[model samples]
Target: MIHETERTAAAYAAVLTTCGDRASAKALARALVERQLAACVQMLPIDSIYTWDGKIEEAAEILLICKIKRADYEAVEKAIRALHAYATPEIVMLPIAQGFGPYLAWIDSVTR
Candidate 1:
């Protein structure tokens, strides 16, 4: 039987990342979902301000929110790194503690 933690309400996680542009964001999202690494991906345009090379920089970016299963995290991370344009892409996973039952069931069914 799957452990309590492992089976907890059907694992769900969101990977957050910023891409250089909409094209890149779309490409990454398609790749992840096509590969079954993510059940769904949502992209949004946003402004980013950060320090790089000891200089403050501001630029427009695309934020990608990926819905994936916890079991596929390693593969997802590897795939994202392989496809990501950034040398160190911001790939963060946030667990879903609670969600709509039907949606959660769909997520579990779609991913491995």
Candidate 2:
């Protein structure tokens, strides 16, 4: 059980990652949710332009936004590294400051 004042101690987190295609995104999303490392994963088609290997590059990718318990962050990252095709898959974690009470509870309940 979580204490009232300590809600932040068991806070929610949003993970950002990009995959080269939808297939990989789908597989990664399924694995995280199935393993209970994340409550939900939202995949979006996006166009990204950035520098890689000292050169500018542009590509289309699937962005995976995962809502999960902060406690499960490490496991989530590890799972991504294992399945991600990119030698350097982006895995960025951000704290969710506040959200609806029930929705936050659902996130905590679904993820370990």
Candidate 3:
């Protein structure tokens, strides 16, 4: 059973970020897992339309959803910044409020 503390503690999180291309996205995903910062990273291709430098821009992007611990959020952001191609990358963290107990436990086991 999942406990209140487990459900509410900001420990479990999914960090989201975007890469300009597949190669970079794959590299970032591998690095995160290798460093034990993320237990898993799910990547998807996406089309992004946004404003930058006061102009609307569009590009093909790859989104990475990293399952990680809240404690590693800073490190994750730092890594993304270091490896990302964009001057300003999109790094967002969403807490995992509730999940399968076994899967959540696996995340804890795999991540430092």
lDDT of each: 0.86, 0.89, 0.89
Q: What is the descending lDDT order?
A: 3, 2, 1
Per residue, candidate 1 scores C-alpha lDDT tens digits across 3-112 of 44445445778889889999999999999988888889999999999998899999999999998987888998999999999998999988876676677667777776
Greater-lDDT candidate between 2 and 3: 3
Candidate 3, residue 6: Cα displacement in angstroms equals 3.4
Residues forming the 10-long window of minimal summed lDDT in candidate 3: 2-11
Tens-digit lDDT track of model 2 for 1-112: 8554358545778999999999989999999999999899999999999999999999999999999888788888999999999999999999886677788878878877
TM-score of 3: 0.92
Q: How far in Å is the alpha carbon of 4 misplaced in model 2?
A: 6.9
TM-score versus the correct structure, for each prediction? 0.89, 0.91, 0.92
Candidate 3 at 84: error in angstroms?
Answer: 1.2
Which regions of candidate 2 fall more than 4 Å away from where they truly are? 1-10
Q: 1-112, model 3: which lDDT tens digit per residue?
A: 7584576466688999999899999999999999999999999999999999999999999999999988889998998899888898999999987778778778889988
Model 2 residue 95 CA deviation (Å) reads 0.2
